[model samples]
Structures are given as C-alpha cells and as structure tokens.
Target chain A: MTISEIVKDILSKAEIKNIFFVACGGSRAACWPAKFFLETEAKHMATTLFTSNEFVHATPVSCNDHSIVVACSLRGTPETVEALRVGRERGAYTVAFTGDPAFLGDPDYALARAGKYMVPYRNSDKLSCLEGNSVKLFQFAVELLHQAEGYSGYQDVQKGLTVLDDVIAAARQKAGPLAQKFVNAYERKDTIYVIGSGPSFGTAYAFSICSLMEISWIHSPTVHAGEYFHGPFETTGPDLPVLLLKNEGATRALDERADRFLAQYDGGHQVLDAQELCMDAIPEKVRGYFNGFVLGSVLSDYLNLLGKARRHDRSVRRYMWQVAY
Target chain B: MTISEIVKDILSKAEIKNIFFVACGGSRAACWPAKFFLETEAKHMATTLFTSNEFVHATPVSCNDHSIVVACSLRGTPETVEALRVGRERGAYTVAFTGDPAFLGDPDYALARAGKYMVPYRNSDKLSCLEGNSVKLFQFAVELLHQAEGYSGYQDVQKGLTVLDDVIAAARQKAGPLAQKFVNAYERKDTIYVIGSGPSFGTAYAFSICSLMEISWIHSPTVHAGEYFHGPFETTGPDLPVLLLKNEGATRALDERADRFLAQYDGGHQVLDAQELCMDAIPEKVRGYFNGFVLGSVLSDYLNLLGKARRHDRSVRRYMWQVAY
Candidate 1:
C-alpha cells in the first residue's frame, strides 16, 4: 500500500487513538512531521519521543499492545530498527517506513511491500538520499492526515510540498544577491546573531552558518529566543545583523514576542520576519518536513550570496572546531 | 540550620518517591545533582523537570500531595517560582532552595525554620556559579547519603568536595604544557566528537563543550557509548576528535565493548574512569563526578592556554537554534 494508505490503516486500528509517533530530531529536518501535524488535526497529541531519548528512571508514555509504534527511518538505521524491536517486545503494534527494506527486518510481507513502494519513489526514482527519503516519509504522514480528516485541504498540503521545492530553488537563486548585500553593507560587522525557537531553531542554526556566515566567511552567533534576556541582550550594536526566523505555527506568538524584543536589539540593523517582510511570496502550509527550514534558507542563502562581493567564501567557515574532551 | 539542614529536614518529612523537582537554567542545574545524590542515598530517584526544556511538550510525570517540589532560585527567577505555585495547586508539598530566602515566600516560616545553621568561617563558602554551586549541592547530597546509609566513607565525600578545586588546580598547573601539546597535536584537528551514556550523558554534554572545550576552546562532540554504531560512525575520521567518556556508574562491560571499536575511529581518544587512576587515592563515591569533567577540563583548559602556539582563536559557544515548526 502507499505510505498514506498505510497511515490511514494505522489510524483506523488506532481506535482513533492508539498511534504513538516517535521522533528524535525536529520534524522540520524531515525525519518525522506527524507529531505536530496530527496533534493539530486531532484531539490527542499522539505522543512523541526522540528515538534515542528513553529513560530507565521511568517512562511517561508506554509502548504496549494498546499502542502503535510508527517509527520513521530514512536509511533503515540500526537504532531505529532496535527501537521498533523494543516496541514490539513491549507488546505494541509496530510499522516501520524506510527506503531500505533489507536494513529493515525481513518480515517478508512488509518487506516486499515497503521495498516495492516507499523506496522506489523516495530513494531511487528521486535519487534522494536518506534526507530526501525522510522528507518523503513526512510527506506520507501529511497525505494521510488529509485522507482521515477529509479536510478538503489535500490540495493545500500538496501545495505545501511544492513550497519546499520552491524554497530550495529560492535559496540557490538568492544566494548570490544576498552575498553581495552583506558584503556592501554588513561586511565588517563584528558579530551577527541568528535567533529562532521551536522547530525553526534548527534551520536557523544550519543556515546562519552554512548559508550566511559560511558563504560570506563572517562570524556570527545563532541564539534561542528569550535567551537574549539572559546575557546576549548586551551584544546588540549598530553594526550587528540579526536574522530572526518568523514563521506561523504553534510558536508564532512567542516568535513574535521574541522578534519584538530582538527588534530593539543591537541598535536596529536588519530584522526580517513574516509580517514585516515579503515572505508571502515564499509559499505556505508548511505541515511537513522542515518546509519552513527550506523557506528560511532562502533568506540566509541570499544574505550570504550578497555578502560575497566583499570577498567572503561560502566554503570557508570558521574552522569547525572538534573539541576533544 | 543552614542550606544543608533545610534540605535534609525537608527530605525527612517528605515521601520523595513521588516528588517532582522543577526549576529553570542554573537553578535546575543546581537541583539535579541533589536528585541524583539524594536518590542514591535515599535509594530512590525523584522525577525532575526543567521549565525551559518543557516549553514545547513536557512529560507529565505522576505526582500528588505526598510529593514535594523543590524550586531553586538565583535572584528569584520567575519560572522556578511559577513552578512552585503550580506544584501547590497540584496538591504537592513544596520547598524552595535559593540564595535569597526572603524572596522564597511571604511569611518564610517553613523556610526560616530550616537551613538555620551557621558557618561563621569566612573561607568556608562554596563557589556558586559556573557549576560551583552545583558541585557543592552534589557533595552535600553525598554527605547526606553517607549519613543515611551509615556509609563509613564520610571523609571520601569530604575529599569529593575538593575534587573540582583539585582538578582546577591541576588544570592550571598543566595550562602551559598541555597548551603546547594540544597546539602541536591538534593544530590540524577540526571537529570534536564526545561520547558517553546513562547518568554520565548529562555530564558528557556538560563537559563536551561547557566543561571541556569551552573551558579550553577545543572543539568536541559527545555521544553515547554505543551510538558510534549509528550515523556518527560515518562522520568519524582523522579530521574529528572523538573523546570517549568512559565511566563506571552504568556498566563496565558496555564501555569495554565500545573500547574494542575505537580502533576504526580516526579522531578517537579515551577518558578512562579516574576511579582507577585515583583508585587507592580517592574514595569510590568520590570518584563519580570529579574524574571525568574536572580532569577533562584540566586537559582541555591546558590546551586552551596553548592557543597562541596553535595560532587559532576560539570563542565560547551558546545555544544557537531549535527545530521550529
């Protein structure tokens, strides 16, 4: 069956509430998106846990016959496999979605089924790596949500999928221009601070360095929201370029408040967000797979591209230090 | 009564099995060691939570009137106080550990009746920041455990109290020599990979950067003992510095097995339990916290002092991002 059909099947057996969505990294990175999406679409939060974050002290949520462990693995990673085995041993129903059925347990029927479908589309057909496969699995979850709710918003979800592609394209296109802008304007700036909260935080981390500072070879700090109050609030100055990730989701309000505080930060250099900028052109309905991370990357990529006029190099990041303890 | 007495009295009257400790940042950091020390001494563990970490979705651990909530404060942080109020509403016993007792509550009767002991000696004060207070609280908990368990190794806990200081002194002493070593040896190293698991994982993270590299400006990455079999295995190379945090609290067998696999890791380094190094010298209970972090810090700090020889400047790191949806 298609991944979406499989999700719908699981939900039907879930008795409207038996599914447990396990997670590790933020869903935006494309590993798992159902946690936030389904919770918003349904009454139950559906339970979430970083695959590796289990505690022997005591488990707040149980994995048993009454539950379904829907684990997502892009490469059929060993840890993910072990986690599924753990759930099964606890008497829980288990279903795994992966691009590598061989790496997955050879449960003949499931193996033949997942290999014939999920892998061909996400791995071979698209030539996507584990990362791309992660995105597709998340896409599958989003598709299933559309079927169960019959929300008539399936098209919106499809558009959201397209938006991810658009964002990636936009990142590449804007890289050069933004690099020049940073060079001509904020080139000599001492320290740039990138800030965001929730799922958007990871995107901010990768882009601030990989896209902007790395591309431009500029030094910067990416911070968590509300952290400015702790001590970094003092780092604001006339020469600082602060990139605030403004996205709409559960954290929109807090993000706005953070933006408000950051606006007054550092003598007011450059502050960009949804309401204050023209990101409407970016696309919407980011219900799956770091869809926003893709969108936000465009801004950082553009900033870095624009900054290169001043001799910044994208490949050159402050030597990524490996601290040996 | 003193801080120690107040904590002890609060424990005597409470059924800690159901207690849940809640606080924020440094305050939460201050209390966790207490839970570990107390649990080991009391032969039980209390449920612990950090407010900021719960901003997304927190595990709703079970608790009731028989439970106690110990809120810690440094300048009466808002979240810690708020958590205490929440606990009271939930029918849980409440306590507050703070630098300023006046801000703990209105009448301060319960607060004042406890922790009243005096230490008039001017030099008797324990340091309160940068994990100083954390160490003091932990050592005191060890002392409390010794008293409760009738452990004859009270002096060992006493020695444990000074381990950090001793490590610090050692760190300072080798600052010159190790700096030169790290400068010459790691001049080409780029990334740091830190690895440890179980209770030590927290400390592994603490030292991975804050206690290790941050103290010395080295780059490090920490992982669980077995996690090396996952994606990190692919990332391991000569360009990285993999610091294995070997400890005894969990299981020596698992650690030994991990040691067998280190030959493939190009950036591999080992931090054997200091219990063996200082076995006859220090007490068993005292060996837990002192050997890894402090000694690692000493080593890393020594490396930092050699920054000039390496010709590379390092900056302390801050929380850069989170996954935003």
Candidate 2:
C-alpha cells in the first residue's frame, strides 16, 4: 500500500490523539521533520520524537491505545524493534519501518515483525536520504494530518512530492563544487560544528551524526541555529570549522543571525543556504517545507566529498555492529 | 501567592491541554526537568520546551487559550520577553519568571511585565540554581499536576522539597574534592563533552552551556547519554575530557552503558553519579526525580573550581550583554 493508504488504515482503527516517532541514530533524526510538521500544521493532535530506547525505558503514562507509535530503523535496529514491542504491549497501534521485507527472517527483522503494521523502505546506503525514511515519515505525517483535519496544504505537499526528485537532482548537481570547496578548506579540522534550525535541523543532525562522526570518524557536533548564541557561539574561533545550514522557513532569521556572526568573528565558516536550492518546482507557499529535503540532498554530496578527501568511506565504523553494548 | 496557588489560578482560568516552556540558554535547560516531569507524570496534558526565539518565530498552532506558556529569563532576556508577548497574543495563559521585582523598571524587566502572570524569582547570581528558576519551574509542574489530577506523588514531592536544601548542602560539601580533582586533571583540555540522560541531562546541559562555555570560554558540548552510541562515541579518545552525570532513574542504564564505554576507551573521564549524592535525604521512590537538582548542586562546585583553576571568571563575557545580536 502507499504511505497515505497505510496512514488511512491506521487512523481508521482507532482515534489517535497523539503520535510518537521513535527511532535511533539517523533514523531518529529522520523523525524530526515529521514532528516539526505535526507541531506546526496540526492543531488537534500532539506529536513527539523520541530515541528508540528512551521510548521503551520511559514509555509515557499516556501511551495507551490512544497513541500511534511510528518507529523506523534502516535494518531493524534492535532498540527500535524493542520500542515497537513496548508500544504494541501498551495497546497502541504500532507502525514499523525497516529494510526490505525479504530480510524478515533475520533476528532483528523477525522481532520487529511483531509490530501491528510494518512498512519497508529503501536503505539510505542504496538511495539518498531524500528517497528514504525522511521523506516517507514526512509523507506519513502529511497524510495523517490530511485525513485528520483536511489540511489545506495537502495538495501542495502532493505537488511538492511530485517534483522533489527533480529538485534534489538539481540541488545535488549544483552542490558538487561547493562540497569540493568545503572539503579542501576544512578537511583537516579536528572538529566541525554544524548549525541549522527548524526543519533543516534534522538534516544537519544526520550529517553530524551519521556522516561526519559515524562514517568519517570526525568530531562533528550539531548546534541548533537558535541555540548557537546560547552557548555554542563561545566555541567560535578563527580556526573553528563551522557549517551553517540556512532554512527558508519562519526560523530563517535565527540562521541568518548566526550567519552574520560567523561572517564577523569566523569568516572561514561555510553555509549551505536552502534558499539557494532549486525549489522553484514546488509551490512558493510550500517551498519552505521542503528545505530539509533540499538540504539533505546537498549534504550527501558534501559528505561524500569529505569522506573521499579524508580517505574515509561511509561504510567505515569502529564500534557500531563490531561491538556489543 | 505560593507556586501552587498560582498554578491553581492558572488552571481555573481555562482547560490547559498543553504547556510550553520557553526560554534560552540556561533558562531553557532549566525547563527540561519540568517538561520531563509533565511528559512522564501527567497523563492528560502535553508539554514542549522551546528556545525563546524559536517560540516566538514558530509558535505552535496548538498554542491558544487552552495552552499554558511558561517563560523564564533571569533579568528578562529580550527574546524570552518576545516569546511571552507571542504567547499572550495567542491567548495562551502566559507565566513569566524573571529577576527581582525591584528591577521591574529596567527596560528588560519592564517589557516582560506584559505576561499575564509575572513571577519574580531570585537570580542565580545571588542564589543557587537549586533556589532559582530550576526549582521554581519544577514546582510549577508539580503543583500543576497536583491540581489537575491529584498526583499521588505530590506528598513525596513536597517531602523531597523539604529536605532538598540540606541534601544540596551536603552534596556541595562532598563534591569539593571531586571538583578539585576534575579541575586538576582536565583544566587544560580544550573541549569537554558532558553526558547525561533523563532529568540529569538538564543539569549536564546547564553545566555545558551556562558554566563551561559561557562562563569559562571552554568548548564544551552536551551529548545525551542515550545518543552517545549513535555517533558521538567516535570522538572518544584518551585525551578527550568527558564528564558523565549519571541519573538514578529508569534511563540510568543508558548512562551506565556510556560510562562503561568511556571507562574502556577513555579511562580519565569523570563521572558525577547522582546516586552517590546525599539523595538518602529524600524518599527512594522520588530520589530519581531529584537527580537533576542533586547533580545541579554538585556541578556548581565543579564549575567554580574549574573557573578558578583556569583564571576565568564566571561573569566574564565577550558579547552576551556587551553587543547586540
């Protein structure tokens, strides 16, 4: 079934007053856009994003049958699977997104099968994040909102989806030289700080955690654009490598403020403004909503080039999967 | 009026379906304990914590007459005051916590008077964080839960509060040696990653942002204990200074996992376990609830010693109030 159809099926089962997006690592970061979407667009339904194990460890007192828990893990992360079980035990309608159903017999996938509904998606390694859980989870949120309240932006979102691939392609093509320039300039820095706000933060988080630290073994940390002035700004120095992802949404001002400061105090900082992405294909009113998608596409190119420059591969990891907790 | 009385008055004004804790920097970290309290303890209400500026820029569509907005700033931060105005404009029951009432004539505190319920509290500079917005905000959450649904732990919370000062004093005295040891070992490090989970995270965040970075100009980033494995663990090296604040709550296991890993990879990392604090003064059932408070008290000693060791004054700031954003 299509994502919207699945959302419809889940909503028809019971009244979902709240939605919980549970995952870990990049998968957890992927849920933020949906959480942001629900927070800004849905007036009646409450939403939360939780790390998978935290969801199981402190299952909310309100997580009963009235809750809808959506969990994602690329290849059935054990904690995420356990979270699905915890949600199911709470009598909440549980939806699990994982790798291909062909791997259902694997121990991780086998346990995740216990969720009420399971949806398989393309792995990020094989496809860009734009085509992976980020977009799918957001589609779930959009559909849920549309079915629940007849969201006026539903049509615009559908139209946006129709042209997202072209927009991402154009963005990736345009970002190649920028990514090369960033790698040449900041490849040797021990730590790189990424900044983003609003929906663009999820993409920033993915780059920091999944690409920079996990894959390239770089010390990269994400600082929310809004929160930069709070404390992270103190870390700014001429030698610091700062990457700012500017959003085109309401929180753009926060990003712009950070950009201005970076220019003054740390002129070497890099910024990838979503406003410069090829978003003309989407409706002008809904273009802001696609900032994450646009930025996520460009970030992939940046990460790929950085990995190559550092003689690191995206598949390299020291402890993940190699070590048991 | 007492905090409980204020909460009661707010509740009587309208049916509050959700609460938003709006602040920036340390104040934003202060709200997490209350947000966590409501998320885990309250069954009928939703809670969200937002950076003050973001709260003003992207105010949730759900924020209305049925929403309760609690904003905090030691002396009326501009963005926080703007957030209070936004909440008031949305017809949210706005509560503002600021500096002493005598400063109400100051421009900062003057504009903050626009909040529907202005609450003046002792600034952190004069008192401990335990006696400042941290405790006050959590009290608001506790009283809110008590009045809304007669929380069974209300008596325990009150009991906890009665002995909190004594517990903090004893913990502070005991922490002096540990703080000195940490300062002597890690004072030269350029960056320190503070780790914590559950309520303890708020204290860790405050230490990282308000103390280490803002005060000492040290590069410190807070890594959520549960999220450390996701990516940040890659940054673990023998030379890296890591401070882990262990919670005594359900999420303690997450912190323990990080502690175990840090022990193997970076044996010099310091840990301030809340369980070892003078928490015996409180009931065991509610002891975990006070982990943030307990650790917060101990952290003051750590920060003070670190500041003296580095010859950096906590009041020193390059831009905070010296320049415009």
Candidate 3:
C-alpha cells in the first residue's frame, strides 16, 4: 500500500486519543508547525511534542494504545529509532518520515507507515526543501486529523496551501532586495536576534537554527516577541541586529509592540511582516493559518542572500555528517 | 496563611488533571525547571507550558476545571495577567508567583493563591536573586504535586533541596576562578552557544537570556544538547565558543556526547559538569532532582564574572523599564 493509504488505515483502525511529535533538533523544530495546526485547527486532539532523547528517558503517561507517535528524522538517527521503539512498546502506533528509507533496516516493530522523500541539497540549498517538508508534515497532520476526528478546517488549510504557492513566489521577489540589503549590512555582524510571535515563532526558531546558525554558520537566537520584553529586550541597543517577523494573527499586537520598542531604541532592526505580503489569493479568514508558510518563504530568501553574501556553502559542515556523534 | 500553606491548601482542593505553566521571557524560562520536575516526578499529571502571549491567544483545550495554571511574572506584565484571567475563565485553578503583591491589584477572580516574594535586586544584581525565585517556584511545584497527587518523590526532593543550599554555596566558590577565566576569555567574543539537556536545559536557557544577553549584553543562544547534533552542530568549529552544562541525570549522556564532539573539534568550549561539583551531600537517588539548581548556581557565578569583566551593570537597561512595549 502507498504511504498515505497506510496512514489512513492506521488512523481508521487505531483509537488515537493523543498525538506525539517525537524527534530531535531540526526535526523537532519541524514538528512545531504541525503542532500549531493541531492546537489551532483541531483542539479536541491532545498533541505533545518531545525531543527524542527526553521522550525515551521519561515517556509520557498518555503514551498508550490509544496514542499515535509521529516522528521525522532526515538521517534516521538512532535516538529517533529508539523513541519509536519505546512508543511501540507502550502500544502506541508509530510512524516515521525520513529522507532515507534504507535507514529503517527492515524494522520489525509496528511502524504503520514510513513516508520517504528524496534528500534535498545540503546547506542553504536545503532551506526551500525544508519548507516543503514542513508543508508535507502539515498536510499529513491535516489528513490524519480530518479522517480521524472530521476536522472541518482541513479544506481551508488545503485552500491556504494552494494560495501559498503563489504567495511564496511573490514573497521571494519582494524579499530579495531586502534580503540582499540585510545580508550586505549584517552578514559579518557577530550575532542576530530573530523575534516572532504566534505561529510564526516556530518559523523564527527554525530559521535561526537551520538558516542562520547551521547554514550560514552565524550566531542567531530566536526569541518570542511577547517574551522579548521580559528580559531579552535588555540585549537590544543601537548596535544589535533584530529581525522581527510580524504575522497577521491574534498575536500581531505583540510583534508590533516589540517593533515599536526596537524603533525607539534605533536598533538595527528589520521587520518582515506577513501582512505586507500580497496574500490576496488566500481568504482573510484563513490567511492566519498559512502565516508560517508565508513567513518561512520570506526568511528563506533572506537566508539565500546571506549565504551568497558570506560566500559560505550552507552544505559544508565541520562536524555534522562528517563525523560520528 | 504562609505561602506553602496556601499552596498546599489550593492543591488539596483543586482537581488538577493537568498543569499549565504560563509566563513570558525570564519568567517563562523559570517555569521550565518546574515543568521538568513535574514531568519527571509526577508523570501521571499532564503538564503543558505556554508563553503568556501564546496562552492567551489560544488557551489549551485541556485547561478546564480539572486543570491548574501556575504563572510567575516579577512585574506581572499585562500579558501574564491576561493569561491568569483566561485560566480563571476556563475554570482552571489559578496561582501566581510574583515579586510584587500589588500586581494582583484587587483580583476579582478565583485565584487560588498569590504567592508573593520579595523582588530581587535590579539588573545583574537580580540574577542571583532570580535563582532564589527559581528555588521558590520548584518548591511550590513539589509541594503542590505532593499534596494534590501524592507524588512519591516529594520527600526525596525536599531532601535534595536541603542539600542543595550547601551545594550552591560550594559551587559559588569553586566556580569563581573558572567563571573569571571564562569571562576574561570570552567576554568580548562574538557569540556563545549554551547547551544543556534534561532539567539543566532551563538553566542554560535562563543563563543565556537573563545573564549573557539581558544582563551582560552578550549574544548567546541556548540549545538543547540533545538537539545540538541535528543542525546547529554544523556551526561548531574552533571559532565558536560553546558552553556545555552537564547534568547528573538521564540526559547527562546527551551533554557528554556533545562535549566529546566539542573536544574533538577543539572549539573554544567549556564544560561545567554538575558531577564535578562536591554534591556528596545529595543522595544518589535524589541528586538528579537538584541538577537544575546546582547547574543554575554555577552558571550564575559565571554570569557574575561576565558582568564584572564587561563592566556592565545588569540593572542598567536601555529600554526594559525605561519605556513601555
């Protein structure tokens, strides 16, 4: 059976009361969009996200026969495999999303589905691909929830994704010059602070790690915009580079407040507002649901410019995949 | 009533099936240690953490009459106040841990308890005091869980804290020289990567934000040690300064693995292992419960040195209290 068919079958048969997104690092980061989807779109389903190592150490009490564990590992790390093993041992249905199917090694455990996708190019080249992976994960979540619990928002999400294709294309063009300017001005800066709120915060986090830190080998920390005032705001000054991702959602006010503070301080700040993007193709009601995708696309353009400006190959790494952990 | 008595009374009456830790920034970071404690010690209780802004935007479905929302805001920001209000509206038992009692401001809702404590010193001076606040929060969590759900590990935790008071003092002395050296060496470095796993991750996050970024105005991002290998590891090289906090628990292996990788690459890396400290006063079975406190105390020492070496007063903020966000 095809992967989607297997997923559907599992959802139909299993009495899934909760969903656990289990992975580590970037993979764990990847789960956030889906988590947001589950929380916002399907509030009835209990969803939890855990780093693989932590999950293996202390499995959640909710992990039982009526639970579904979804894990994604691009490289199929042993930790993730172990987590899946533990999930199965607890009688939870297990599923794996991977870039390399061979890494499964003929697993005997009850893995309902192993969705495989081609590995994307390494480094900054992987940014766009990672976004695609996010979409895949989000779509999978929609399908599972829709089938199991009859989530009504699944169609809206599908429509949003359809509109997002054009939205992303336009965003790339519009963000190019800003991305270039940002890269030129701050490529050599010691550190950058990336701030976002609402659903877009996860995008901020993924961009900081996958694009700025991993791909460009620059130091960037993502802070939640609302939380920025509590303590992190003290780090801001005329010299600090702040990237504020403004999403048109319930949390937009938080970002606007932070942006105003940054403006007052005259910090080297850049605002990437999803509301500024021409998302007319998407209905205003559903636009909030796709803020993650729209913002992610704009940030990817900035990351591309950064990679080009620094003359650093995103794929090249000193430790990752070059040596064993 | 005394704070502990109030806490115990509230816990005994509330039917808390789930617990939510809701706050922003530093306060949010502070909740993590207790969240870890709850997860490890009271596995039967479902615990969810949300940044105040996020929590207010979309309150969790599980947050009902059978839930408890515990929040801490030193200044009682409007966002956190809103979260507490939302929790009350949802019929969840609400508790506030704050530095200012007046912040509650003639509360009309059903706030089970408002545990007020003396506000710490402002600026870098506040860092040490914040550690005390964390101890208070953890203690509240232990007492609440012990009274409400009868967790078996309460006495062990109490024993751990008894020993931790002395351990923290010893750590301060032992960490002084090392902290001074680290400060002198990296005070001016472009960025620092702070990594920790298990319970210590919260300490790493707090130190990075409250100490390095907010207090010292340094660029530091705390990463989960278990997630370090996924993508961020690619950024590690001889140029990047890495600070690894090794805990004495199930997650210690993750930190040691990262340490080994750092050692191999010969990066400017420092390992502050909790096991290295003279924690002989803590029993083997209960030592893990105090890892966050021990590591936090040690890191606080380093923050003190960093503040001194940089000649930056933690209390001197350009925008935090000077301007409204």
Summarize candidate 2's per-residue lDDT along B100-214 as a digit string, tens digits.
6564324456435868886677644335545577888998998898899778888888889888888888888888888998999999987788988887778888888878877
Please give me the DockQ of candidate 2 compared with the native complex.
0.70
Better of 2 and 3 by lDDT: 2
Model 3, span B228-248: residue lDDT tens: 877778778774788888888
**Clash number for every model?**
50, 0, 6
Higher-lDDT candidate of 1 and 3: 3
Compose the digit string of candidate 1's lDDT tens values, residues B159-191.
755555554454446444544544465555544
Best candidate, TM-score: 2
**CA lDDT of each prediction against the hidden true structure:** 0.46, 0.82, 0.73
What digit string (tens of lDDT, one per residue) describes model 1 on residues A82-185? 55666666666566665454432333434223222232224321232323544555555566556545545567666655555554555445444544554466
Q: What DockQ, on C-alphas, does every prediction get? A: 0.06, 0.70, 0.51
In CAPRI terms, where does candidate 1 land?
Answer: incorrect
Interface RMSD, in order shown: 9.8, 1.4, 2.2
Q: Which segments of model 3 are wrong by more than 4 Å?
A: A1-14, A40-44, A100-131, A147-152, B1-14, B41-44, B100-131, B147-149
- The 10-residue segment with the lowest total lDDT in model 3 chain B: B115-124
Decide which is better by DockQ, 1 or 2.
2
Distance from true position, residue B42, model 3, in Å? 3.9
The 10 consecutive residues of candidate 3 chain A with the worst lDDT sum are A115-124
